[model samples]
Target: MPILGEFREFIARGNVIDLAVGVIIGAAFNDIVKSLVDQVVMPPVGLLFSGIDFARLEWVLKPDNPATKANELVAIQYGAFLNTLIKFLIVSWVVFLLVKAVNVIRRRDAQHPEATSSAPPPQEALLMEIRDLLKAQAGREEPPTRH
Candidate 1:
C-alpha cells in the first residue's frame, strides 16, 4: 500500500503530468510530420528526380528464393531512410526556430525586467517586509505601511 501511495504521488507530480502530455503531443506531431514527408514533400522531390519514389528505393542484399520455406526478400531500404532524414531535418529546423523565438522573448524580458511582472517575487516581497520590520524595531525608521 505504501508503494502504491508512493507511485500515486509520483504520478501526481506536475513534471510527470507535463512529461506525459509532451510525449502524447510529440507522438501526434511525429505522425503529422511523417504524413507531410511521405505524402506531400516526397512526391515533389520524387518528381524532381524523374518520377523516382523515395519510399520504394532499396538495395537488394539477397533476392527471394521460391524454393526456400520462407521466401522473404532481404534488402536495405535507403529511400525510406532519406525520407526519414528529411523529416528529422524539418523537425529540427522548426524546433530551432521555436527556441530562437523563445530566446528573443526572454532577452526582451531581461532588458526590461520591471515590465515583466507588476509584483516582486514572493521571496523578495517577504524579505522586504522583514527589512522594514527590522528597521522599525531598531528605531531607525517609521513602521512599515501596507500598500
Candidate 2:
C-alpha cells in the first residue's frame, strides 16, 4: 500500500528511532528520580516531620470493620502522593536545568563556532553581464573584419 511505503520512509528517516531512544532513556531516568526522592530526600523530610516515615505514612479513607478484613479497601494515599509529587518536582527541575544548559550551549555555538568562517558573496549576475558584453564585443569585431 502507498501508506505503508510512506510509513516506511518516515521510519527510515531516523527521527522515530531517536524518539524511541529518548523514551527509553526517560523511563530509566524516572526510576533514578524515584530512588533519589525515596532514599535521599524523604529521610530528611521525615526527620523534619518528627521522624515520620513517608512510606509507612498513609490515611485510611474507609476504616476496616474490626469484625472483618474483607472488602475493606480505603482511599486517599496522601503520603505516597506526596512522595510521588516530590519525585515529579525533582525530575522536572532536573529536566528544566538540562534544557536550559543545552539551550545556553546551543546559543553559544551558534554565536561563535570553533573557527568562524564567512561565505563568499554570490557573483552570478555580475558574471552574466560580463559574459554578455564579451559576446557582443566579439560580434561587433567580426562584422568590422568582414567589411
Candidate 3:
C-alpha cells in the first residue's frame, strides 16, 4: 500500500482513536484538577495554617535593596513546590482509585465467565463443524498405505 493509504489505515484503528480521545479528556481533567488545587483546596488549607499562601511562600536568599546599583530579590520558592506536591498527591490518589475500581471490575468479570462469555457465534460453530466433517471424510477415503 502507498504511504498515504497506510497512514489512513493506521489513523482509522480503534486504539488510535481511543488514544486521541484520552489525550483530549486528560487535558481537560488536568485543568479541572489544577483549578481545584489552586482555588478550592489551597484556600481552605491556607486558612488552617494561619492564612499562609503557599504560592507566595519562598526563602529569600538575597533581599531586595533600593540603594544598590544592581539589586535583585533572589529566593527559593518552596511554597509553590508544596502546592505542586499536593496537586501531584491528589492526582495520583485519584488515578490509584480509578485503577483499583477497574481492577475490581475486571476481577469480577473474570470470576464470572458466564456473565460475559466469549463463545463462538453460531456461524463460526457451523463452519468448525463442517471443517471437522471434511477432515473425517478425507481420512476415511484415503487409500491404504503399503507396508
Q: Pick the candidate with the highest TM-score.
A: 1
lDDT of 1 by residue, 18-115 (tens): 99999999899899999999999999999999999999999999999999899699999999899999999999988899999999999999999988
**Residue-wise lDDT of candidate 2 within 1-147, one digit each (tens)?**
699999999888888999989999999999899889999999999999999988776777888777886978586778898898898899889999999999998898888986445543469767888899999988878454453
Question: For candidate 3, lDDT tens digit of each residue in 1-147?
Answer: 999999999999999999999999988988988999999999999999999999999999999998988869999999999988988898899999999999999999999989888879999999999999999999989688999
User: By descending TM-score, how would the candidates be arranged?
Assistant: 1, 3, 2
* Residue pairs whose backbone atoms clash in candidate 1: none
Model 3: residues >4 Å from true position, as ranges?
A: 65-71, 117-147
Estimated TM-score per prediction?
Answer: 0.74, 0.70, 0.71
- lDDT minimum window of 10 residues, candidate 3: 64-73
TM-score of 3: 0.71
TM-score, model 1 to reference: 0.74
Q: Residue 18, candidate 3: how far off, in angstroms? A: 1.3
